[model samples]
Target: MESPDRTVHVAYDPYVIPGGRTIHGRADGLNGEWSVHLGRQTSVEIVAGLTDGLTRPRSAHAPNV
Candidate 1:
């Protein structure tokens, strides 16, 4: 799945394959740099929520760090 603006991309694989990655993501940052992320054996619920959040629009208000 990808964001509406095509700035973010994510992939997930639930199958258990040896040395196979479970999740991969690429995003274009505000700083004009690209970021990559990888995950293995991550929880389904967590990945689901991450995908869900990426597909939705961000809030106008900044989040508390």
Candidate 2:
């Protein structure tokens, strides 16, 4: 189990565009493809997906719809 203050990482395949445009699409509804154990006294619920870095559109990266 990880602490609430711990960092949570979410993996996703991003769309890419020419010239390195990057965008992070919104997380899938519910995002319930996986689960995590918070702790003995805590439970896991409503897990949201996310990207590794800022979810901004980077022309040099890829286009995320």
Please name the candidate that would achieve the greatest TM-score relative to the true structure. 1
lDDT of candidate 1 over 19-55, digit per residue (tens):
2223334434543535434457566677677667656
* CA error at residue 37 for candidate 1, angstroms: 3.7
User: Where does candidate 2 stray beyond 4 Å?
Assistant: 1-32, 40-65
Best by lDDT, which number?
1
**TM-score to native of every candidate shown:** 0.44, 0.15
Span of 10 residues, lowest total lDDT, candidate 1: 18-27
After superposition on all C-alphas, the RMSD of every candidate to the true structure, in Å, is 4.1, 16.8
Show where candidate 1 strays beyond 4 Å. 13-29, 32-38, 59-62
lDDT of 1: 0.55
